[model samples]
Target chain A: MSETPIAAPDPPPGLSELFLAFASMSLAGFGGVLPWARRAVVEQRKWLTAEQFNEAFSFSQLLPGPNIVNFSVIFGSRLRGPAGAAVALAGLLGPPLVIVTIFAMLYTRYGDIPWLQGVLSGLAAAAAGLIIATTAKMAKPLFEKALATRSLDAAPLVALAVFFAIGILRWPLPYVLAVAAPVSIALAWFRR
Target chain B: MKGDGDILLTLAGHFALLSLFAIGGANAAVPEMHRVAVELRHWMTDRQFADLFAIAQVSPGPNVIIVTLIGYQAAGLAGALVATLAMCGPTCVFAFYMGRTWERFREARWRNAIQSGLVPISIGLIAASALILALAADRNWVAGAVTFATAAFGYWTRLNPLWMFTAAGLIGLAGYI
Candidate 1:
């Protein structure tokens, strides 16, 4: 979504560093990768600055895939070229892929077991908590910036309102989106 | 009766259509996934679907990997492979190939307008999905409390998420097998 500023390309980070950085982030990823990803790429490794991260993130958001997976490809490509992108993709996905594959296998074998099913129920609730928590943590900066600009404006507020009305209130989602989406965007245009 | 292959084909058609509508991510299409899994195919019971989702939730990678696991159970190895590739392949190709070209459209008035419009749509979908997940997965007061408390804690506090998971683990220990 950003217009490119004219400048020479930044030098690529080394392969080893890319691998190590992704590994660090992956291991630390608790509720989700966003927190660890923020710590690793922006705070610790200095692979990309905050401005660059946001630009890549916008593109990631625009893409029709998981944002974190897209971030792996975009950030890795920027930091290490095609090979770096490949490495980042593999590193980021490798653990989960392997683990899921194994779990899928075991699940196919043992999933009908009643005890296993009971355990998964509790775990699933926990997963919901995890997802909500992670989204909350990521939302802080957006919330802070909105308050700082003294713009308790409609856009972000509407996004949250739309979310609450649909999520908590159980409004039909398509109707909620149809009504709220344009209004939220218009709020942004006005703020600009 | 339709051959097993035909059932797989039917599931594939469902996923393919769902794939196109997945604007936000793998996570975005989940409510539809639940609809199909529960209402359409009858491949699983509701509790089973909720459990599959939970396992997917705790795992790394994309949230949709559970689709594969569910598919495998319903149809076998081919089902797993078909569901995995079908769920992810279209979106990945769209991103990897057309991503840069998309950025060029950023300057267009309607393009900007579309994004502005899309933001709320996506948010709505996400919230709906989260709520569906909560309803389907949360079976008890303990589970409900964990979800609410965790969400509030995550939103308002700076607690390490790992610690939260640890707390959940303790809760799980009390109730889970």
Candidate 2:
């Protein structure tokens, strides 16, 4: 949608600005950085529009490893080559490593306390809910797109097959994916 | 017991492979991580694995931090460093090259097809991860209720998730859940 012919108002960000932006987002990201990253990149900095953000994020998701980390690298690389990618990655991961280490130390020392254990259990339950919600949010758009496009009937089928294999049957991931991914891709290619 | 170096090497090798397979993001690999860490290797109990995942979620930065914490549990600071690098390093290089190609082929029909096919699979994997996590975390009716309630709120509202976590934590601190 943002593939506009008009010129952008601002120039691209410098390496320092990119680093600081990622660092701030990392600190602010409590549950997941995807939302925070969206705000910082699309709204605050105007580095990418909403459409561009979605494109980059979707592409990042398609690659292996952490989606946001991959997004950081690709976005930074796009902006300033390898150096930008390095700086942005450092900003994203550096602070949290230190903070999490401190938390690890504290948990190790006092983790056996009954009340603390209760708290951790509660947090785990909530985290489960959060993931479900994230899945729902992600699915809504895809389903809508599928219906509108008059294709993607196989998409939901593939999704259900994967869910059954991994979630219910407890099959190994690589094997199920090895079979499922190719079939899904070929289906899409033929349908398209 | 394995030596410290052996443990670190195992962690490095396992996470490197996991990184490549984490197509839907780090959360997609949660079940495998749980299987390896708790069931296969016995690095820690199921409870500890759940707790570390929760801690990573509550803390800032990417969800990938869970790998770092798991590595630390298995070994030490050195383990954390090695695991984090192994998990992220190859992926970074892959993304660097793939992203460049993707931009070049922004309008390629094949790229569109691949993306469409993969999106649903990623969604399915994430749902599986959620199911496993719920099974691990919900030890009682109250905890299960908390999971249901949080899912409702998260889906219906735009409230920051930290608030929900805080409410649940307060419930726990009160010895309720």
lDDT by residue (B1-177, candidate 1, tens digit) is 457788688767777566656656666566667777876678887777777777666666556567777777678777876776666556555656554466566577666665665564565556556777778777788788877877777677887655765676566656643
Q: Which pairs of residues collide in model 1?
A: none
TM of each candidate vs. truth: 0.75, 0.92
In angstroms, give how far residue A57 of model 2 lies from its true place: 2.4
DockQ of candidate 1 against the true complex? 0.40
Docking class of 2: medium
In candidate 2, how many Å is residue A178 off? 1.4
Check candidate 2 and list the clashing pairs. Answer: none
List where candidate 2 sits over 4 angstroms from the true fold. Answer: A1-12, A140-152
Worst 10 residues of 1 chain B by lDDT: B91-100
Superposed by TM-score, candidate 2 places the C-alpha of residue A186 at a distance from the truth, in angstroms, of 1.2
